[model samples]
Target: MSVRDPNPLDSRHPKRVAIVLSSPAISTTTGWPVGFWWSELTHPWLAFRERGYEVVLYSPAGGRCEADSLSDPRDPSRYSDTDLISLGFLSTPKLAALVEATRPVSELSVDGFDAIVVAGGQAPMFTFEKATELQRLFVAFFEAGKVAAALCHGVALLRYARLSSGEALVKGRTVTGFANIEEDFADQAVWEMGALTRGTHLMPWRIEDEMRALGANYVQAGLWRDFAVRDGNLITGQQNFSGAATARLVIEALGG
Candidate 1:
């Protein structure tokens, strides 16, 4: 899916950005379906498109991408009503169609895009945590000096992603991701729904723990607040709230 610049006479080639999302996956702990977060994708998408960048959506396992129900503003739980940006994006049928179907990352050439932004959700904990291909793609973007970013659980990929130098991508770099306190709150919310009564942790490990173990200079804002960090071309956001901030940083890195 592509978004053309509003100006018809503009002949210059627009910047290209790729947004990688997770394919639908069932949460082992909750026994509920999970996928990409709505705000995490939509907010950054808006930021990129408004700057006249052509964005494409891709998935590790291509095809239709589902949004985590809790992140849907229309969900009965009303947990994300304040996500007006996603709501607005979802309201546009043509624009929303871009996420409904996605190409596989394997089909996308790294050199075709200037940057890549990995979207976050519960599924990333399961799908992206060990995705070697995604790890390679992200590392390529970083090594090429392009803007490479991952937010929230999407940052889980960095735990095992290695650079050509055989070091973890986040090693010795400042980064942020879903925090332990944030995970605690999420687990509490899930437990309230009886998903934890079956004796399973929402995620195998917290992103903060994994990054810190890899010697990353991990940082975070207060629980649930917007926070993002940029260490050279590597950009990361603390949680869903930081999506736009992360996208803006990418734009800055691209000199947009």
Candidate 2:
């Protein structure tokens, strides 16, 4: 439950991190509002802060960013109603302000940061892969031997992010993301709720399918279980629930 117990020296020298979120976008498949997942951001932010690391929020483009409706703790759908962590984050004026107005990735670089973590939601399926600057920053952190992590659909960056050597960053690495089986359930839930057709999909492509295509040693756990995979400086989480677990891997990799 610890957020930050600041070290006196932190002001002079802090371990800075860039936590990236997908920009606000209308989902092509669902035609619904989407951005980042609330828990995916709040949980990992808490984890990193607990270590006194300064976590800066960023988006593909600067300005206010939205959260997928279902991820909102106050949403009428009640999908994330039990997420007190997000509820607390949203209630706090200072913490909530972080996501409301994010700095654009294009305005920053990998220069001063020691790590980067990408949190995902419906928007990443439509935004992350094509945001060259975001991918570049993620890859640059890895190439510099710094911790680079992503959770849920955010892991999609690994599919398209390439090293300076001109090869996929995920190649030969063990990883996990939003799985195909979970995607099936998400589609089914929407169908039962009458928001989508029986055979329609909420995602244009499956994260599992693409990660497998990249020949990474992809693995996952039971539905909604907190699972994370760490391969060197690269860390990945299976879903939104895996945020803190994945951040711990990043902390370990940083020798915390």
**Candidate 2 residues 1-256, lDDT tens each?**
8676333335557688889988899988878888899999999888888888888988989889899889998999899999999999999999998877899999767887888999998899988767999888888899989899999999978878989999889988999999888999999998998989899999999999898888788999979899999999999999989988998898788766
| Total colliding residue pairs, candidate 2 | 0
Global fold similarity of model 2 (TM-score): 0.94
Query: What lDDT does candidate 1 reach at residue 23?
Result: 88
Every candidate's lDDT: 0.89, 0.88
Candidate 2, run of 10 with poorest lDDT: 3-12
- Candidate 1 stretches greater than 4 Å from native: 1-11
Query: On residues 1-256, what C-alpha lDDT tens digit does candidate 1 reach at each position?
Result: 9997444323288889999999899987677888999999999999988888899999998888999998999889999988899999899999789887899998877899999999999999888765778888999999999889999988988887899999888889999999999988888877788867644678878899989999999999989998899999999999999998899898888877
Which stretches of candidate 2 lie above 4 Å from their native place? 1-12
